[model samples]
Target: MEGFLYQASIYLAAAVIAVPIAARLGLGSVLGYLMAGILIGPAFGLVGQETADLQHFAEFGVVMMLFLIGLELEPRALWDMRHRLLGLGGMQVALTTLVIMGGVMAMGHQWSVGLAIGLIFALSSTAIVLQTLSEKGLMQTKGGRSAFSVLLTQDIAVIPMLALLPLLAMPGGLSSRVNEATDHSDPGLINTAAAHGDTGMSLVDGLPGWGVTLVTLAAVGAIILTGIYLTRPVFRYIHVARLREMYTALALLIVCGISFVMYLVGLSPALGAFLAGVVLANSEFRHELESDIEPFKGLLLGLFFITVGAGINFGLLFGQPFLILGLALAVIVMKGAVLYVLGLVFQLRGRNLWLFTLSLAQAGEFGFVLISFSRQQNVVPGDMTEILLLIVAMSMMITPLLFILYDFLSRRIKDADEALEPDDVDEQARIIIVGIGRFGQIINRFVRSSGYETVVLDHNLAAIQRMRQFGVKGFFGDPTRPEMLHAAGLKDARVLVAALDDPDAAVRLVTFARRERPDLHIIARARDRTQVFRLYQAGANDIVREMFDSSLRAGRYVVENMGLTEFEASELQRTFYQHDRHSVRELAALWDPDMPTVENQEYIARARELEAELETMLLSQLEDSSDSDSDRKSA
Candidate 1:
């Protein structure tokens, strides 16, 4: 117990120390965890050499992550992403495998060995890619979505890959020795269970091949049915318990129970968790389950990455530094080139293409499983397996650096693109609209109809093209670019509207415009209260939340529906709007983006008090008006 505590302390301390520093240095938390693992594992030897054990445990993080992802994607949403999942993802796996297999065969490897290696190399690190994309706020972007689809396909493909491995095994090639080697080396859950003499517990243990397959299918069906019918009621009962800790325990229990069931049936536990999540996607408890499991997922995921880092055979790397380094680079280049070409064929242009290519160029954690399995099956030689493992590890290590490079290159390209365009401020307009998307379009129409000259700009090429088809002209350039702003004649513009769909970009544009043209009146669109606060900080003269006006209009209709006259509803709405606007400014003043949770709670409480006070005052005024009218009629 003491030794266990010591080990835990070391791992926790390393994460606590390393992650913040990495984040502060602009490196992502995933990279931070990996670096921490490297530092503690091989660099200083703060942790013991039992990385495999830690890895086996930490892989639950990946399972949990997949569950969260499944929860976010409803059946309809999954169906919507089918084209990209099938076309982009399917092509990527097929082409990448073919390319790698061809290369391996040319190097005098057996066909079976080459095929195994190709399939293994085809998959990219889902954990790393998704975590990085989420951290950088790119998961909603075109490239990010494409990458996600591909990752999902690869994960699904693992089932078939597992089934295919036995067929590729060479017959009569020291099968006993292979089994012995596998017992010592295979890190997979099934193999680990077998190593621990838990075969009797496996659902497929005594079954024939067909029976085993049937049972596996049955297990999956059971999970789906339970998710659809039984999960909600179970969670609803747990909710009535009113113990958050119990709810959390129940969430973990569901995930673990499903995982164990999948393990028994010889399937990927992560895949099982994902299916279960899909089942509960529309349930009221989905968000609660996600919130409950998120911390565990994050911590475990960090531990998983750290283990990946620590498990790297640095001794082997140092012994054949150039060979290993060359192999790693070759894999990245080959995968990236294939992805880039695929992106182009799929109509991904400019930044999105590069993002898709760079993000998915690394070998995945599953490569470890495949390599170990291949060695055990005699499909790949022991020496070759070791090399492949090292290469995969190196590739994983390089992924974060690749993201950094992408960011740097993207910024430079954006700047160069802006610089290349000559700033010809020929057509000057009084109102300069930074974004001509849905929000800006309405604003532009209002200004144009009011007889004000307006110039519209948008960064999306496709959007600009579509707008031109509708006879609405919009310049294609990033509004955050100072050069683009100047090209739009910011100097002589009387008013500037920051109406970009991206809140961060909108904030950036507002900050730049406010600094450059202090005399110019700025109208900024915010998506939420957080953005409202940010826009206010950016010197937006008028900040309009995108949904606020529409909600108010809805409220007015509700008042009319509740037996109030249209005029009375309108008047009440006007009063409420004024009060709400005042409240927003006051709240914004109290809101520090980095404020403590306790202080934030206090602020929220104060705001509620103010709202109640305003409601009472409004009712009092209305009563006074009614009483005055009654008195006048009597006179």
Candidate 2:
């Protein structure tokens, strides 16, 4: 127990210290975990051999992650990706394998050895790629969706890969000897069906090939049936317990139970979890399942990456640094070439092309599993197993850097290859709306309904084009650009409305417009109080907080439900609004852009005083209303 506590503390401490710093530097959490592992394992030796065992346990995170992903996708959506799944995904694995196999054969390796190596390197890191894409908010993009389809296809392909490996086994039958010499616990750190060992339990034990197949099919069928027919009642029963923790426990139980079933049947637990998730996608309790499983998924995935980093054999890596590094690079380049061609063939251009290419160029966590399995099957030589392990780890470690490169390229490209040319400004009006998003659309509709002519401009060409389809004329151009503003009649416009979603862009437009047209009245949208102050400083005549009016209405409803009459609620709400506006104007003068709001003493004191004043005023109004009601009853 003491040892477990110490190990937990060390792992937790390393994560805490390293992850935030990495995030601050924009290196991402995966890289941070890897760095933390390297520090604790190789550099400091604070953690030792147990990292291998912990790796197997930590791999459960991948299962949970797939479950969560499945929850988000309905069967229909999965079907829609069938083309990419079969075409792009199939070609990637096949071409990458053939290419690598040829490379290995050229190096004088046996055909069996080359084929084994090829299969190992064909797959890419799913956990890292998905996590990174999510973090960067690129998951909804064309490239991201394409990558996901390929990943899903690859995951499904793992079953056949597992079946094929044992067939390629050498005559030596070195399974036991290799298991002893190599760390089956580590296996170069990947989530694969190969990791589902025959220990602790087995439903398919000693079964014939046909029996195993039937049991696997039955297990999957049970999962689908359970998700459709059993989950609702099970959740309702758990709901009767009324404890929040019960819901969480049930969620964990569903995941763990499914995983155990998959393991017993000699199938991938992650695949089973994903299947269960998809089955429950339309369930009423879907969100609850996601909320309960998300944190565990993140933590476990982090632990898995840390294990990957810790399991690196630095001794061997340093011994053949050039050869190992060269092999890793070769795998990346070869995979990239295949992806690039596939991307082009599939009509993926510019950012989407690069994103698909660079993101999946690294060898996946499953490479570790395949290599270890190959060693056990005597397909790969013992001396080469260490090299393969190092190669897989190195490639996974470098995956994040590839994503960083994608991000850099994305920034430099900025959709120039695909962006339509800015629409010509052919007309000018007295009033101009700088953005035509949700906030500006309402204003445009109102003004047009009132028979006032106004020019609309926006940076998003798609949005502008969409508006045109609805008979709302809008020009596609950056609102902050001086030429776009002038073309929109900023000089002659009486009122300029800045409703851009980007706060910085709105500020820039307001500042430039105020300078160009001193007499113009500018109304700018502010995301929050800080943005309100920013817009005020930029010389916007009126700054409207985006949610301020809606929030006031919601508060009024709350007070009305709290025993106050409708009239009384209205009076209180009006008083609050007036007081809030006055307080904001006063506070705006004290707000220093250079200092943190919490650290500004004068601002803090004034804010407290304003809060007290508002409370006292509200109480006085309530008392007056009560007295008036009493007098009316007496009369």
Candidate 3:
């Protein structure tokens, strides 16, 4: 017990200390985890019991991570992204695999060995791409979304690639004597879940394949049904229990339990868990669950990556220097070539094409599992497999630096152009949005789509840099300054919205905007009651709250009327500008943070009913008035 406690403590401490320091150095968490893994596993020999055992456990983390990602994507969102995934991602994987396979085969390795290596080399790190994009504040930009679509497809493709390993094995039985190989696991949930495969239909060691498959299918079917039928009630029960700690614990339990159950069925736990997460995203408890699980997820995932690093064999790498280097080079070059062409076909021009290509040209974490499985199945030679694993580790280590290089180059060009594009002294845009957050993003879309030119002003250097990638014209300076506003075309803009997320920033910008363009309609953001009144005092013509009213006014109508869903209704209302100035005046004046959600729900329902009733009543009065006038005229 004491030894178990000690080992667990060491793992936790290593992750806690190493990840932050690595991030601070701009090397990213992938490197941080690698450092942690090395410290815990081989480098320091802290938990140096055995390398392979530790890896088997760490591999679970990857599975869990994938399941979680799957949960985030709904069917519709998945459909929307199918093009990029099937086209861009498939092309990237297929072409890269073929190219690398040819290269490896050309070097006199057997075709099977070459095929195993090529598939391993085809994948790029989704974790690295998403993390870099988010860290750089490109999470919502067009380029970011495009990258995300491709990454999503690649992640989904991991399952099929894993299934393909057995087919690539040679006729000869496993030749090399196993170096203390761990006995095969009892056909647990994973194998059962994958029972659709050829081997999945047969007995491997002892477990009944048919029974396992049936049970696994039943488990998945039950979970899906339960999620659809019982989530709201379960959440209500947790909320009523009212212990914040318990509620948070329950959320974690739900995620972890579903994930574990999925693994037992041979499905990816991360994908299963991620599906649960998205279903509950709209719940009131979402923020709480996110806050609780996010910290643990990060640390565990870091441990997973670190384990990947520790698995790298420096001895093997040194022994076959040319092979390892040649493999790594071929993998990167092939991926880059495939990505560059796909980007061009997808109409990703100028900077985004390079950003997409350069950022994703590496062997992915998934490659480790693929190569290892292939070797176990007698598909790849032991030495060849070891070399591929080393290459993956090195490629992952270099990915962050590659991304940073891209950012550095992108900014240099943007800075040069912005400096050179002199302001039109006499002509300025008729609309301006400050901050460019979600709220500001909406206003910018609305104003620009309505035929009014809009210029965005923001203080965040990262946000400004990201927006430039999407071709958003903006002044990357504080809107609180008179000179900055003038430079941003604010003085000439007929409408200025201080839609910053920060209340103080919004107020400061509001005051500056009012002073500079007194006649302009200055819409400002408010966090609460006090902030709205504060904005009103500061001469804001319109003050929108940061909560639901500000975000949802345009969305509710399409839900009551059409075949539209929440997202579609929201988008349509936004596009049509149906919620006019008068409707906002009626709603915004009375909003308070302390107001209960039930009351708001009742009010919206009542308002819709009242609107119909009043319209009918007005029609009746008009008819009577018209008859009286006609009677008087006849007399």
* Best-matching candidate per lDDT: 2
Q: Residue-wise lDDT of candidate 3 within 145-236, one digit each (tens)?
A: 67777776666666667668778878765544122122323111111122222333332325486876687678767677666667768878
What count of clashes does model 3 give? 17
Q: lDDT (CA) for every model shown?
A: 0.85, 0.88, 0.67
Over 1-635, each residue of candidate 2 has an lDDT whose tens digit, in order, gives 99999999999999999999999999999999999999999889898878877888888898998899999999999888889999999999999989999999999988888988999899988899999999999889999999988887787777788789888877875756455445545434332333755555788888999999999999999999999999999999989889999999999999999999988887778889988999999999999999999999999999989988888889888988999999999999999999999999999988999999999999887777787677767778877888998998999999889988988998877867336577779889999998888899999999999999999999887788899999989998777889878888887899999999999999998999999999999999999999999999999998899899999999999999999999999999999999999998999999999999999999999999999999999999999999999999999
Best candidate according to TM-score: 2
TM-score to true structure, per model: 0.79, 0.92, 0.63
**What number of clashing residue pairs does each candidate have, in the order they appear?**
0, 1, 17
lDDT of 2: 0.88
lDDT (C-alpha) at residue 350 in model 2:
82
lDDT (tens digit, per residue) of candidate 1 on 595-618: 863679867887898899789877
